[model samples]
Target: MAYDEGLAHRLGEALGALPGITAKKMFGGIAFLWNGNMLVGVIGDDLIARVGPEAQADALAQPGARVFDFTGRPMKGWVVVDGAAVSEDSALDDWIGRCREFVEAMPPK
Candidate 1:
């Protein structure tokens, strides 16, 4: 299935100012990377965020969040935010910021 083009476009605009960021097609969607590490992406209209293991639980507690189980097995540090949760620009920005925080702290790949 194809991802939401509108969501992908919003993400692009939100991340446009960040340095060392790149967008690639993956998992049949668009993945935004930070210094080679995946920060966030869109899959079938959902917002996939790399919140890291430390913040996984907290992130999951938010409304419209669930384990990112794209591979059939859940990825421990990632969560998929419902498209409804990110309908607003501020909401999307918040998710992107959370992803950026975790990805930026990691050693460059």
Candidate 2:
């Protein structure tokens, strides 16, 4: 499977209530964008979070998170969070909160 439907649903529920958020198919899974800036996403059972350069170190320090390296070279401002780490609402919310700060600052595209 390209992605986890259950995880996608749960992510949907977590992000649905926010204004300006939109879900779209991307990178063989799904991504949630806020005003045209990607905030978070799912790939297989992992969660993809864009925490920006400033917060990249802190985000990587979180349990189950690693540098997003889909293209071989590591992406500094992004991370892939393990499904286990985000199984809880609190944990998922924390990711969203971190991503929100960066996404919100981007100009709408």
Q: What's the CA error at residue 8 for candidate 1, in Å?
A: 0.6
C-alpha lDDT (0 to 100) for residue 101 of candidate 2: 88
Tens digits of per-residue lDDT for model 2 on 43-87?
999999999999999999999999999889998799999999999
Q: What TM-score goes with each of the models?
A: 0.97, 0.95
The TM-score, computed over Cα atoms with residue i paired to residue i, of candidate 2 is 0.95
Clashing pairs in 2: none
Cα lDDT, all candidates: 0.92, 0.91
Which candidate gets the maximum lDDT versus the true structure? 1
How many residue-pair clashes does candidate 2 contain? 0
